[model samples]
Target: MIDETPVLDDHLHLDPDHHRGIDAVRDFARLGGTHLLVVNKPSWHLGVEAESGEDFREVFERTIDIVDEASSELEGRAWPVLGVHPGLVSRLVDDRDFAPEEARDLMQAGIDVAAEYVAAGEALALKSGRPHYEVDDAVWDASNAVMRRAFEHGADLECAVQLHAEASEDMTAVATWAEEAGMPAHKVVKHYASGRLEGPTPSVMCDKERLETAVERGELFLMETDYIDDPDRPGAVLGPKTVPRRVRWLLENGHDEAVRNAHVETPKRVYGIDTEATLDRTE
Candidate 1:
C-alpha cells in the first residue's frame, strides 16, 4: 500500500535533537514517502535563542548539514530548502537590538548563503515570508522587503521560493512582489495554504476539498503536513507520515492522477528535483 505511488513530503524539519536524523527520514519512507524537502526549523524548535544574525546562520548551517546527512544515509531521497525565515528576520531586527536596515542586510546575507548552496546543487529552494497577516505595518513591510530580497536572489539563481505566510492572508500581493522582483508565479509557492487563494502555486494541507479543488483546476500545487517532528508535541502539526497517508486516501478515492501530480510531478517541477533518481534509491 505504501509503494503503489511515489510520495514527496514538500515541507518538514529534520534535526538531530528532535527528529533524530535518519531515524525520522526512515519513518517517512516506511510510510510510503519517497522524498522530502527539509526546511530549517525555527529557534524554538532548536531549543535556542536566535538573538543575532550569527545565531540564525548557525541554525541554517546545521539544517543544511542535517539534510546532507539524511540524503546520504537515504541515498539522495532527502533535499534541502534553505532561507532566512521572515519571523526570524523580524526577531533579529525588532527583538535583537539590530536596526531594521542592519537586519535587512543580514537577511540578504542569509539568502546569499542559501543561494551558494543552491548553485552547488546542495539545496532545492529558498524560503521567506511574513510570520503572520496581523503584524504591525512596520514589521509587515520589513518582512515583505526582506522576502522580496530573497525573491530577487532566487530569480538570479533560477530557484523556487517558498512563502510561509498565513493561510488567510491575501497572497496575490506576494505574487505580485515576486513578479516585480522577476520571479515567475509558478516558482513562488504559498505554504500552509487553505481556502481559495489566487496567485502562486499553493502547497496546502491534506484536506479532501482543498485537494479536490487543486486537482479539479489542474493546478500546479503540492501537499504537505508541515510536520515539525517535535518530541514534546508529538505530531505537533501533523505526523511525519501525514502526506503519504493523504496520498493513500486520495488514491483509494480514485484520484490517482491527482495523487501523482501532487506527490511527484508538482514537487519535481517546482523544486527541480530528480524524482526518478530519488525514487531509485533503496532504503
Candidate 2:
C-alpha cells in the first residue's frame, strides 16, 4: 500500500511459548512491514540461568526458528539478532550473588556463543549493551567490558550490534569502545533511540514526532517498535504493527525518501542484506 518500500523493524521479540510467535509476524506484515530483526530475549527470560556459553544456544536457536518460520510462512522476512542482554550482569550480581567479575565472565561467554551463531551465518547481527538502570562502579565496569567483547565479535563478523541502552546513557561515549574493538561506530546500532544520535546508528523508536525531526535533519536511522509479544503486557513498549503503521504515516505525509532511507538504505548498510535479496533467498 505504501509503494512497497519494505518497512523493517530494527528491534523485535517473539514469544513462542505463549503461542504468539508467528502470529506477531503476521500482524507486522498485515500492516505493510516486510522484514524485522528478531532479537533473542535474555536467557533468564527463557527460564534458564545460562551456566555456560553453550547455554545461550537455546536462545539463539529459538530465535532462528522464529526467523525460519516467519520466512517460510510468507509472513515477511525475519533475521536473528542474537547476544546476551547486558542486564544479565545485574541479575547475576544481585540475584545470583555472583561477583561482578564472575557476572562479566559469564556474559562474555554468552557473547562468544552468539558470535559463533553469527560466524555460522545463522544470525545477522549481535545485541549488547550495559545495564540501563543504576549500577555501582564494579558492575558498570564489568558490563562495559562485556559490551566491548560483543563489539569485537561484530568487528570480526562484519555485522551490526544492536545496543540496548537509554538515550540518556552511553550514546556518545560508546564510539570509543567500538573503535577499540575494531568495529566502526556506525556498525553499532542504538536501540530505543529518538532524534539525532551522535555516534552509532539510531534505531529510532516508532514515534512520529521524533521521526519527523530525524527526517528533517536527514539523519540515517532505522525504525523499530521494540515489540515484546506478551499477552499480559500487550503493547507495552509497542505493538508489532507499530513500525509499518508509522511508515504509512510517513508516506501519507510525503516523507517517502525518509522511509526508504530508514527501512532499506540503512538496513542494507548495516546488515548487508535487504528485502528483495532476502526474499529471493527464502523463495
lDDT of each: 0.74, 0.84
Model 1 error, position 194 (Å): 1.8
Query: What would the TM-scores of all predictions be?
Result: 0.88, 0.95
- Lowest summed lDDT across 10 adjacent residues in model 2 is found at 274-283
lDDT of 2 at 109: 94
Best by lDDT: 2
lDDT of predicted model 2: 0.84
Backbone clashes, candidate 2: 0
Segments of candidate 1 deviating more than 4 angstroms:
1-4, 43-57, 72-76, 281-283
Q: Candidate 2's error at 136, in angstroms?
A: 0.4
